[model samples]
Target chain A: MKRERVTLRFSPDAYDKAITYHLVRDYGLVVNILRAEITPGQQGNLLLDLEGEPADITAALSYLSSEGIKVTPSERQIVIDKDSCVDCGACTAVCFSQALLIRAPEWDLAFDPDRCIACGLCLSACPVRAIHSKFSDPIEEAPPADEA
Target chain B: MATKTIAEINEKIRRGEAVVLTADQAAAMAKEQGVKAVAQQVDVVTTGTFGPMCSSGAFLNFGHSDPPIKMSRVHLNDVPAYAGIAAVDAYLGATELSDGRPEYGGAHVLEELLRGKAVRLRATAYGTDCYPRSQIESDIRLADINEAFLFNPRNAYQNYGAAVNSSSRTLRTYMGTLLPKFGNVNYSTSGCLSPLLNDPYLRTIGIGTKLFLGGAQGYVAWNGTQHNPSRPRNEHGIPVGGAATLSLIGDLKAMSPDFFRAAYFDGYGASLFLGVGIPIPVLDEDLARCVAVTDHDIQTTLFDYGVAERNRPSLGTYSYGELKSGQILLNGKKIRTAPLSSQKKALVIAKQLKGWIEQGDFLLSEAVAPLPQQATLHALNSKDEVK
Candidate 1:
């Protein structure tokens, strides 16, 4: 039987691979053990694709959540803002798993969540303040209005 | 101002509809499309900009007859709408036919005319700076019932040249350059650059021509705003100005078959081009200025921008040579690639590789292809291992 894969999606702004990198490095999760995919996006979000034993997937989720990696049932993806980003040309180095890439000198940075082993080493390396954690602090929902 | 549903608005238009939905009505419809609020109260929908509007006309021939089909303006109209946005004018172009019908001639005329053409529409309701949508809608509903409300290009062309900028000389020159052709045209000289970009309702109007001409570099910050500075200038190491941008207006008409083209002119304050369309994205104005450079020079620029790699996303297994070679074979077989080239197959070899790269299944290697000279990739993964 084919093992079912758990899918997750980060908020467009939360698609930072740095959080994934941290999960991989500190959590001992194998970046290549699962699938990471960038979905065809109108909003252009990066998705993480992973598959393994149920325990392993659970462990991956735990680690991802601890690192603030946002996961959804829909996709494992990150959204990149091309304008606010400055291409430091650095994220190309730490991704031994080959998940992060500098597309070209002129274009801003891009991350291949598929190749990313969820390693977070590149998180600190980015100088331009471009990269972000997939799971940022959850936004507080507005309190229910008083129904006098 | 309560926004109206698309059905209600369409119904009004259908039912000899003079009912102007309140701003709220329009905003609510816009909200369904992920827009928050209609920043401007104009019901007039403006379209996004066209890319490759520059240079496409320069090197390539769109195949128009020599002396390039003489275009003349038949009519122009400056219309006032209740939508709170500035009055818009439409220009129309009709071929001078011998037997009362146009001699369906060349490609460029149809192409360029359709690309930049805008027709003037008739609107009746007019009020001061503040007119509630409900009031406007009721007024329009009550006004004289003329089924002819849509703007025609001919009327737009006639009045567009007459719009007075701060100075008559500059405005006259603007008219002279554009008026000669008289093809369908849509341009706003009211200096309302900011609204064109941020207005949710206008932005949603998927089909319509809109252009913002003359403004400052600072305005580019707002989405969808395109400003062409009056001179060839640069900002933040990016060049802005000259006929570079003016030339692009034609280029966009030449390049894309989809969507009408829009142009913006902002005085020299910034150096960059910002455009949003069916395929929305901002391309640096400096790159546009590179139109002055040769193909080789442009290729060099593309290399700097990482065009070869970014343009072609792939994983480790595929190489440019193999893809090209595959094309040759497919060509011999008369096979077509789907979306990518023309093999017309699901999951081409290169796209599969790209899937792998994105999925973390493989490492991209230099074996794929030699990095073009002046190429650079700024990956965000620190552990990026180039295998």
Candidate 2:
């Protein structure tokens, strides 16, 4: 089984389609919605964790692209600047997923990107402005290829 | 009971025969070999804490300008500094926020200054006969300043309560963010390794007491603001909650940016993360017992920050042992716990202070006077308004 994390951005026009339902029923992919920001008639984004055969995941991605849904790999969503972090564990107060933690005995702050759901909560909790979210700003689609 | 004086310890230190240990090490040793035995074997016990201390700032003397001006209003990098004193002298408070940016404030400016970075200095003054220049703006580095000293009014709180939210909404506070329904618990102070907790009675820590402040030698100037030494204590004489505080003074020019840092809470404001360490002389069994406090022996109250008032509701009392275990039972539910204070850095400070004492480079000081053991907090009466 193959597991992957990806961000799905839906334009306003793609709001009516049942994206998650189609991915599960047609493509035979298991979808876990890590986070979602969807408002009716407005552009929305979903951070998802997909698990299935590699071929099935690829087919789902192609299907999403055909529906005009932008897919970006969610390889690293949270970035913590080690030089600025004081290991105070303030970010852990808001981190429900336990992605950011203070290791026992040593008391040093450790971050696990795999556990992070990209909630963007730690970005504000950091005192020295050390934590940042790549998805904090709205994802913008690439400009249409210039007509020849 | 074995006893040792500051002078005697200093003598041993100079002779390279003194035995120094961090509070953690000393506490463990005392636990294994009773207080009396440990007191006879150890010469000094050092304690340290690195946490958010909002009541901290620096006083700077920016030397005279070519055309001098009695700076009535001063700002360092847009954060206002109190310039009501001398011509070029000003005090920058850690909590002072900039006009445009709330996150960037006095603490950030202080950190920048310590990093040896040039900061924008702006001041305006009423024209005078001897100092005619009304306004001046320039970039100034820490090297350019004649003198810069940290004169914090309050720091190294003896013991503080853990904060939690019992309400339905999240609250942003200096204690860090608290989730609703006791979703998480946040506490500051280095517990067993905390300077004040180790010297709970203020015996070895008082006016003239030498200490490691932000990587520089500093002195206890006075009893810090809101210093309530009369706070209720446990069997060990340690306060159950926030109690005695210290007013510290140190040379900022010798401070390291590593120990002195700027911090910001999401919706709250800016504050300084200060590293403070104090060495306690093993005067006698009493002093030795005090410094032997451990996480299990020290107790702190958990306060509900959902109230949003000076007096918050207390959830319950728990030892540092339970809190540091990463979770505590509140209302029969397991609530995850986190610390706003950096325990790792506090240990580092304690170890550094121990090294200095072992090398005979740092010596203990006798307090000039004892801090008051009886003091009460007075609340402001809003009805008494001046006409």
Candidate 3:
């Protein structure tokens, strides 16, 4: 079976109702309500495992956009930053992806790269703020890994 | 060149020998034996207001303008008194013995099935009636007295891996949608909807080691609007508790197997009719083992029964002895029997079917076998006496 991966950033305000009809309903994916972290006033990331034709993915995006969802191709295939990550543990606490972790000292906070969907969730999750997204390049770099 | 007789099968079963056959072998044997076969059946029987509807989650949503969702009835009044009779008839072309003598050759078939005991039932009233939540619970308790039952929690929930949409463009292929979303995750859908959709239910049946072992989540709900409320003022009152949701995630962090171990290597069993597309003899032994395991890992829950506050499990334990020996359920009631085997049904069936197919006699085929000869003979005898 063919499958595609896509991430849509829900406006931080897209709360309960958005979770119901949009992400979970239209896409057949479940967004971790608990793993979400928004920077006081910033867009939140919704990772979706889209299965079907490329047209279907585009259709879902169009529907979401029309419904007032702010979606963009995610950057930074990896979620966590090795440097400046202090291992302070705020990212892990807010991460529903279970992608980021604070193991300890210099070696603790490692990005699983494989588990990271590049939803840019860690950007807001990080207390020290050291994560970067791929979209900021204003163009395409490479399709992210199929991990998440 | 000689096919085994019922007596020989019985002897092997009596001696506790393994019953084995591949689906091809079972089909060939059944064809040679002249037994009919039917595969993949869904029989939904509802006692009250709710009927089977397709939604990934337990709770269904209704718009005020949308009519009330009523479940249609599914009946199984004619299911053979015993679980594997269809397979037995299909295998040896012989009827089940009312005399209680063990059908030894295929005893394993009767032994390996994972027959459901605790039949969970849940319903919520949307109109004028008092939230006789107690009565709904009472009916469930009564049903529980008759059979093991399940009721969704007090909230409505949707299926996590389901795609619900109004347009054709949204119709993602079921197979395509399965993996990207459900693949690599250990998840259990609410009682395989494939059966309801007239599709094969056990198609996804396999071991945790064979498929992705996703983590398990429980108590998922969906809240949707209700129509025809007795109190017009409370028009916005949405109904919950319409469904139950659970997810199994397959990941290393969970220490679960990434691939569900490939078992039941041969033959196919439909979750709907709980029928297998193989020789009756092979299916019988396979199902018997499945039942034994199912009998073991069982529990039941009912609210008015007040079992929630109690330590009683989800489905009760196996206790077949009290239920008229041959009759598994007494008036639809379980007797807390013990599992005849150690492994689950899928595992046992997988092993037995694989073993059977390796032998030359096994076959895989399909047909709905005729009613047992004894039933025919008894009817003929009664008519003769009357004449």
Candidate 4:
């Protein structure tokens, strides 16, 4: 059994299909969607954690691919420009994940990326344009051409 | 023993023998060495603050051009400036926004001016004999200007209250974005390091007192706009929250951009994060003890911005140290806390002031008249029309 956090992008035609229902019934998987955006006959994106047998999850991905759906890993990180950041702590207020906080005594900002979900809400909250989102591109982040 | 005088301290500064410590250091030393001993040992206690000071502006005297005209209407870098004074003199407030962009304001213009950048100067007026011109638009740098002086009507608040949102909606405020429904908290004071907070009583800091103003030598010009000395205080004589403020004056050309940063509130207008440091000479043991105060000893009420009015409901009182904890327990819920003022910059200013006094480059002045101890701020009454 395995659990993986994945991002699924559905095309206009794929949006109408009951993929979530299929994952639960046919594949016997527990699909927990963290975030979702769907527009029937337009497009859709779902951030989900699929809990099922390793082989079954792989089969489900192939099924999604056959349905003209794209499967990708959800790997997002928040990057803060220390020099530009005035330490105003504007992002910390909207940070539901508690990744950004002020240090004690001196009152300096501290960022814990491990706790951050990379919700990207704080990006706009920052007045100085210091906070940013760094999405890991699997195509580029893969092993270098020479190393491979 | 005769009370120590500003002249006596100035003599020590002249001799390069003045002893100076930060407000926190003075208070800590007083706790250990006692106020009397510390007072006799230390010559000065420096106080500092780096916060978003909105009530600040600079009066610039633009050199007359080929076709001199009365600048009845003036704009500096697209930001409007008050030009009612003379043909070329204008007052650019810190929060006045540029016509193109609301976030860009006089603060940014002044900061650019400090960096020796040229600002757009535009004006319109009726032609006259001496100044016979209807319109004038030109680029002017700080050096091109005849004179520029910063006259902040209010800064260095004695002790300011903290703010929190208790209502169900997120409140966008100049206090930094307050989280909805008391989700978190925000404060705007440098606490123990603040000049007025240390003096609290306005004892040593007064008109004519020289200070480290925005990285240059300046003076306390007058009492700030809201000089509420009669406000409530704790047993230590320090006002509990929001009392005593100082109006300051300094040459804008002598100011540094490092001590001043332009701030744009998410919803509110532009404001300048001004850095000001004042050296308080310990004239007596009582004054020494007061300067020795710490963050734990000081307290300010938290206000809920949920109420849309001049008077907001007070949540509770918390010490600077307690508020610095990053989170506070209110109504059984842990509310996160944030600060708009920078203690890092405040510490740097305090250290810089201490070095200036040690180098004999800065001198402290005794308050000619202590700030009003009984003055109350009253709302203006409407005059009934006798028609």
**Candidate 1 chain B: worst-modelled 10 consecutive residues by lDDT:** B295-304
- All candidates' TM-scores? 0.20, 0.93, 0.22, 0.84
- The DockQ-based CAPRI class assigned to model 3 is incorrect
Clashing residue pairs in all predictions, respectively, total 99, 0, 110, 2
Candidate 2 residues B1-387, lDDT tens each? 687788998999999899999999998999899898778999998888999999999999999998999999998999999999989999999999997866898999999999989999999999899989999999999998999999999999989999999899988999998989889999997989999888787878779999999999999999999998888999999899999999999999999988999998878899999999999888999989988999999999999999988789988899999999889998789999999999999999999999998998998888898878778677675777674
Q: Give a tens-digit lDDT track for model 4, residues B1-387.
A: 326888898999999988899887887887888878777888888988888899999999988888788889999889999999988889999999999965799998998999999888889998899999999888889987899999999898888889888788777788877877787788888888888877777777777888888999988888989988888989878787788888989998998877877877778888888899988888887787788888888999998888886778888889988887778889888888877888778888999999999998887776666667777787654598353
Cα deviation of B60 in candidate 4 (Å)?
A: 1.0
Q: Per-prediction RMSD in angstroms? A: 26.7, 2.8, 26.0, 4.9
Clash pairs detected, candidate 2: none
Give the Cα error of residue B154 in candidate 3, in Å. 30
Question: Which lDDT tens digits does candidate 4 get at residues A8-34?
Answer: 776665577898999999999999876
lDDT on C-alpha atoms for all candidate structures? 0.26, 0.90, 0.26, 0.81
- Please give fnat for model 1: 0.00
Name the weakest run of 10 consecutive residues (lDDT summed) in model 3 chain B.
B42-51
By TM-score, highest first, what's the ranking? Answer: 2, 4, 3, 1
Write the residue-wise lDDT of candidate 3 on B1-387 in tens digits.
123333454355445453443322333443454322211110011000011111111111111112232212111111112222211111110111212322211111111111212222222333333221221211111111222111121111111121112222311121111112111111111211111111111111211102111111111111122211121111112111112221211121222111111111001111110111112332332222221221112111111111222222222212212211212332354321111111122222333334443342333222223211111101224455656
Alpha carbon deviation, residue B7, candidate 2 (Å): 1.3
Candidate 3 residue runs with Cα over 4 Å from true position:
A1-148, B17-144, B148-170, B173-348, B352-387
Worst lDDT window (10 residues) for model 2 chain B? B378-387
3 or 4, which is superior by lDDT?
4
Whole-model lDDT, model 2: 0.90
Model 1 residue runs over 4 Å out of place are A1-52, A59-76, A79-134, A137-148, B1-49, B52-387
